[model samples]
Target: MTEESDSPMTDTDSTTTGPLVPEDITADSPFTLPGFFAALAEGRLVAARCTECDTHLLPPRPACYGCGSRAVTLSEQPRTGEVISYTSVNRPPSAFDHLAPITVAVVELDSSARLTGRVDASLEDVTIGDRVELQVRDPETVDIDPDFGLSYEEEWPIHVFELI
Candidate 1:
């Protein structure tokens, strides 16, 4: 087989732009969640873009799910997006009871990458097509219970959205 092929299984082109081996996927690489969150904490949103298919992978991985290609590269994502769908969670898990009636939305960013996150608005205030901007918060700033599966040392960044 050559470098290019129409069949997904036969597409063996190695556009491998980023890490190509396990030893290269360090915490400093955006290909991992730790690295992804690290960038978020620094006020930057990053994703993996497949060179072969233009698929954007949030919380980036090494391979492209779209064309089964391993030629993914780090990409900075946009903070603004529109609300594609939303809902209110009146009954949340016990650990998140303090945040009852949480409003969540699946936002499609300007790059067409979609991610689900809490919206800093009441259910009644949010609607389809509403413009919003991403907000990254230190986990401690939020009222999540300590036992919410995250340890103090591993304080993860919380992603949310606010109407623009």
Candidate 2:
């Protein structure tokens, strides 16, 4: 009788091969926040795509929220998207007060994944359906106060949207 592959149970299948095992969820794996930020810092945007229901999970989780399936795989996301909604934060939190009147928006990426981010334009310059591209910047390069980041988030990259 064939021993069904003879691999250890602790092994996690490749991202596109099968369900995500507990062994696959690690700080160095894209399924976790640290891993997600690490990939973002490297100029790669990654998300979790559920094989069972085709749901995309940003800041990727191990399980598929759409179908409660663990058969999720890593998917690279497109930088271009359309603005779905927007608003201006006239009174942002104290940590972001220095950049008040910030224009933010919900963008639906070309991959159908959506995420909210700060827009480079002013509130008056933005409108629904505007084309935008994601921009990545080092945390220190952004204008926000240095203290705004938590100790653990000091190295995470910040993302913004630029009108296209």
Candidate 3:
């Protein structure tokens, strides 16, 4: 991986070649929720925060389960966390029909909130309580986009370590 300088550029005379934005991932039914897609569009991981307890909840719900607060705020989450549990899916459901046996892990964020995502690393290297990061790989660069309606580009990979 190469590091690029984070310099602000003027709109009129900028000469930096930034990363290419990849196509958004889409899904049918519940996965197509507006809030869910909005987070990814802005390159942020959004979760619901409880107004009463100030607790962050992943896979955000309309109301906080902890305090039953309807006044919830959708906020970005840190990219680092520790693996609480995980499992490899040799036979995924129909929705994940296109992905080869992928490993999924339940990660506990620094805030103690847990969210599940694909583990990009090898299965042998993954373990409970291991440090893991969130990686957003572009499907286009990899030339492998599943036909399940989700699209991604390969050249612009966004990987963030939430825990280590």
**Scored by CA lDDT, what does every candidate get?**
0.80, 0.81, 0.54
Residue lDDT tens for model 3, 43-154: 6565666656766666555567787766655555666677888778887766555665767888876655677777876577788878766665453433234444433322
Best by lDDT: 2
* Model 3: per-residue Cα lDDT at residue 113: 63
Model 2: per-residue lDDT, tens digit, 1-164?
Answer: 11222221121225553334667567888788898899999988888877788888897787878888877778878788889999999999887887888999999887777899999999999999888888999999887888888888999999999998
Which parts of model 1 have CA positions greater than 4 angstroms off?
A: 1-16
For model 3 the local lDDT of residue 31 reads 20
Question: Whole-model lDDT, candidate 3?
Answer: 0.54
Q: lDDT tens string, model 1, 1-164?
A: 12322212111223456578889889877788778888889988887888888887887888888898888877777788889999999999887788889999999887777799999999999999888889998888888876775553365689999998
Backbone clashes for every candidate come to 0, 0, 14
Q: Per-candidate TM vs. native?
A: 0.87, 0.87, 0.62
Misplaced by over 4 Å in model 2 are 1-14, 17-20
Q: Which ten residues in a row have the lowest lDDT in candidate 3?
A: 9-18
Clashes of 1: 0
The superposed Cα distance between candidate 2 and the true structure at residue 42, in angstroms, equals 1.0
The alpha-carbon RMSD values of the candidates against the true structure, listed in the order shown, are 8.3, 9.7, 11.2
The candidates, ranked best first by lDDT, are 2, 1, 3
Model 1: colliding residue pairs: none
